[model samples]
Target: MYQLTLGQRAQPTSPCGTSTDLRGGPIPAQPAHPTRTASSPARVGRRRCRPPPTDGYEGRLVGSGLSGCRGGGGGRGGDGSDCIDALGRLLTRILRHMASELNLEMRTDGYVRVRDLLKLNLQTFAKIPLKSHTVDEIKEAVRRDNKQRFGLLEEDGELLIRANQGHTVTTVTSESLLKPILSADEVSVCVHGTYRKNLDSILHQGLKRMARLHVHFSSGLPTDGGVISGMRQSVNILIYLDVSKALQDGMKLYISDNKVILTEGFDGIVPVKSPISRRHLSPSSIREAKP
Candidate 1:
């Protein structure tokens, strides 16, 4: 039989009534996989539990901090670090790519019932062990995602979740993405931060999506910490977006729930003819921005 060692979690009070689907139809939460634990095995006729993968996958348990994980449950160090990070990665993949796989609408908002996500993680899509996580832990992982990738929704009192941006599926509309362009207008400038090494390529080829969808940009550099998510070493340059020009040119620019400005995709993987301002950010300048 399959073996599951993850600890138990208190199921949140799921309010009654089905949530409205993309078409406003009722879609209720009907979980395919019930919670399992090492102490309590599934029935003899049921599926056998496979032990968690021993590789780094088991090194971290992502959500709903359980008591039975490696490195003593889900704090910030040891397995906790690995667990949350894995959850982030796994969720990102699923959010950005699951529409076609799951037979979902292109712009259906990428809303997956929490229970369905857990079932998918435990069975279908997972290739590693340590995929176990509780709904609470999943929620925590969403909260911790640095790029503001995932967004939570409570529809008709039924909790639902979705990716904030970076969707290849066109089923979603700008209104569904929300935050409004008026909000985008309030920003003095939006910025894209990248390492200094890529400046030449970017200047020549422009910032390409490479894969997935959307060209991610930060609304602005924060006063503390590194601007945007991935910045290696201490040196990087900032590319200021011409938001007004982009909008005027009819480019479909969007702001992620996390305040990052993104485009559906750039033409020819190069920036628009829109006027973009550039600046050199030294190590000292970044340090000075910090509180």
Candidate 2:
């Protein structure tokens, strides 16, 4: 019911004069998508096969001295060119694999990682300005390009960035967000209600739970309540509760170990440091020391 052409199922010829498939398997009855006729002079001249071009990507490839054979320079040229094209296709496959494995969303200006590139032997395709460039030079070039595109630079050999806004907002370190709340001593909790009845109920509940601590409620949101001020041995706590006809407010609690010092509206857990003491001197000595 099915028919196959000889050229369509022909196996590719290996350099060793044996038929081979693309995966190095035994030669099939026909070649896949044969570009050259069987009687074509190019096929009998020992020229290598060129890989088909891929869509949406472009690159160049170079070969080492081993690519050429003795005599027949034209044949060598054709073979070398074909080898380069094949290498380019392989490199493209590597890039695709890296993008998929690393969860990298490739943009027109974006690039693959140097580690991934090296793993795929992609440095071979990079056109070095000099005929002989060192490995370090290639690495540095890749690093510089990656940093410029990603907006993150290595600081003291560490990758550091204030924020990365790719799909979600991500902070460089936890200290950026957690420090303020951890270093507070006395927190003022404020509650507000849209209606008078709701305010009265909230105030009564606050009084029942926190008789010793100061609590306040008003018709609108509290303004001066979130501020944590001069806390020695941080002992105060702040709780805010809001109830309305539309949404229910949540409750939260905080615990501290060190003295919380709230200054300039920033809260953070501060470590103890050596205190500065005033130097003692006699009145006559102080007068003599004055210039």
Candidate 3:
């Protein structure tokens, strides 16, 4: 914001000018210092010694023209104290803009992912004047706000955030939703009551047999013994079919890892990999699998 100024221009002079005529003559010498008179005893006590008058009296008295002249070291303003304050205000404005953008995005999305939201939040926090609060404190504040705005809640003790009336998405806690299905010693068929009913059915059944059925619930799924494989941990599975009827109906069992679970409602079945067949099937085997 600082600008430079130009000095006044000099008029053209004659080629041969005489002193005291067109050309300027040398000025008489002036007193180097202001003469001081003898002072009364009371004034003498408060009087300060002055520096010797010299050609560069102003420069000497002012010390270096740099900002270090005052008690403060050289700063952004060169010699004035205004620069630091101006810089602080500029930084505050930039950070405020960034914070505003982040808040807008969060509002539009209803629920922002933890990882994605941290970048902007961290930037704003870093610019805070006080160093007493840490990045973690800022993150906690953001998390609390997000939870309040989006109805975020913990699923299986893990953070699972969602917007109000938002579709329930699958997460690492989905496995907890399978407790009801697994608890039944008898084969139980599960179904998604939401969208894509057929697709959900096939996926759930196939994923279940392959030990891939994972469901997430508001309350954690039960993990009692005798639960089916793929139903003990976090998974996206929505429906479970009670295929125990197939075994009781005298169907010849050709169990293998490649076997797929099929329900009467679905036209086709999905492929899945099961760790154990009927001969060695147990809740422990399914529980041990990695979701």
Best lDDT among the predictions, by candidate number:
1
Winner of 1 and 3 under lDDT: 1
RMSD, one per candidate, in order: 15.7, 29.5, 34.1
Clashes of each: 14, 10, 17
Report the C-alpha lDDT of model 3 over 1-291, residue by residue, as the tens digit: 001111111122333323231111221222233343443111001011222112221232144332212222123224322222322222222221232433423332223333333233221111122222223332333343311212344445444323321112322122222112223243332222111223334333542222221221111122424322222132222332233433443322221111112221212232332332222213334222221
Reference-based TM-score of each model:
0.59, 0.18, 0.17
Off by over 4 Å in 2: 1-79, 96-98, 102-109, 121-291
Which 10 consecutive residues of model 1 have the lowest summed lDDT? 1-10
**Candidate 2 lDDT, 146-210, residue by residue in tens:** 11112233545533221111111121122321223321133332221122223234233322222
Off by over 4 Å in 3: 1-182, 185-189, 193-240, 243-291
* Model 1 misplaced stretches (Cα beyond 4 Å): 1-81, 102-107, 121-131, 169-175, 182-184, 222-235, 265-279, 286-291
**TM-score of structure candidate 1:** 0.59
Candidate 3 global CA lDDT score: 0.25
Query: Tens-digit lDDT track for model 1 on 1-291?
Result: 111011111122325435532211233443344566764322111111232233433435446264223432223344455455556656665666565675533335567666566655232212223235566767777888776678887778656678876665555665666455544456655555554456667665677765436666665555444344322122245555556666665666666666666665446253633233333344446433310
Native-vs-model 2 lDDT?
Answer: 0.24
Q: Candidates' lDDT values, in order?
A: 0.50, 0.24, 0.25
State the lDDT at 149 in candidate 1: 75
